[model samples]
Target: MVSKVKIYVSGRGQFAVQVAEALVEARHHVVGVASPRLRDGHSDESQAMSWDRLRAWAYPRNITWTDSSELRAHHIAADVDIILAAHSHAFIGRRTRARARVATIGYHPSLLPLHRGRDAIRWTIRDGDKVTGGTVYHLTEHTDGGPIAAQEHVLVPPGSTAQSLWREHLAPLGIRLLLRVVDDLAGGRRIEVPQDEELATWEPSMDSPPLFKPELIALPGSVSVDSSKWALHGQEGRDHSRPGSTA
Candidate 1:
């Protein structure tokens, strides 16, 4: 695969630095960043630590940071082939979206077309899915129904909480999977299959439901389906046995 390619990162979240670090490890040229302004607005201690980590990590990577609050002419004027989003809640307009020569990939945790909104990892566990995996897909006007480009499956470990599982497991996996997608795209492999709308599911960005975890150690008086515990669902669909097609 091609090495040392130019890439742009969008988002002010922890995932931004994680992807940058991994890409640096793989020797990719991080051109610049156009994330939303960091909320020096109000931050608690844990939030501070995440910010500290982001600061410590990004400094060495030498990424040009743009306060998305400002104009894009500064960062988006550069030549780049890939645009990567980590915790990017904003939609891409023509300017930033046009910078990429190849494609822009949005990374989502749930086997999307399923959980199409925020708190995907938390929602999947809350919903009692037996299997949920990561998906990397082309970004379009819609939330996450875009055609899939590449995906990697990860199982939620046992006795995991929403806070613990995401903070620990899925976050790093997302960065790794996205870099793999970048490598695949760099290889001139642009094969994609349309998502099955019949099985498509959508979750609202707001109004989250009560998370269920099969509370096994509960008292006998309240022994019902452990709605609080998480289980995996829809994993068998990932086993792609089909042959490759040329672009």
Candidate 2:
């Protein structure tokens, strides 16, 4: 078992909120959230204060909230262990990462360095990938490319879509992988796997839809898809127009 640690979280809502809940469940102190009002690409209207909803979901847990933008003004924590981020779209420059007690890790939905950018789940489903999964990795300057600390595989069923898969599968596994990584970091053991260059892939911002790729998707059975979406920020939110990239 690892010693208890003080954690300064970033972002709010599902990804950030769930990770905070899991950390507390694992017996760690969630010192405060570097709560960002906006999730990367969302409009200001959709990014209002959400501590109320967060409290509803995590009522019994004693937690604090701080503006993520004001991170420099706070008192430094004693034994600030590691960082857990997913849709935490704030800038965690090397300065903050270097100050932590453990790894400043992030979670990605696809096996990297393949599908290395956002919209991974969407891309996998669109590309007719029968398999895709989750990974927890150390955060570097790049997006999802980093030392993979731990990963778990998930099978993409035939005819899967981002919306359906997230509701059923991805979200749940994301939380589990986060807990495992937190535990491993707390225990001072980093069992990581470097990404394979040969298998590495990147998602361009303008790629066509999975349904757009008839060869890979239609070979077995053509699965019709809806590739239209409004812009949604936050590292890994589902994009119907495109699958989301990871944090």
lDDT of each candidate versus the true structure = 0.59, 0.60
Candidate 2 lDDT over 76-132, as tens digits, reads: 364677766655545566666666767777777777665655577767777888888
Q: Residue 170 in candidate 2 has what lDDT?
A: 73
Return the lDDT, model 2, position 9: 68
Give the TM-score of each candidate. 0.72, 0.72
Model 1, runs deviating above 4 Å: 39-62, 69-74, 207-247
* Poorest lDDT segment (10 consecutive residues) of candidate 1: 238-247
In terms of lDDT, model 1 sits at 0.59
lDDT string for model 1 (1-247, tens) is 4655788776555666777778878877777776544444545545534343344455565766665445253466457888876666444655666678887776777676666555666667677766767777877644565689877666777776665566665666677778888887777777476776656655433333422322211323433554445333211101111000000
Clashing pairs in 2: 41-233, 118-244, 118-245, 119-243, 119-244, 119-245, 120-244, 122-243, 126-210
The backbone clash count of each candidate, in order, is 16, 9
C-alpha lDDT of residue 131 in model 1: 71
Instruction: Find the 10 residues in a row with the least total lDDT in model 2.
Output: 234-243
Global local distance difference test of model 2? 0.60
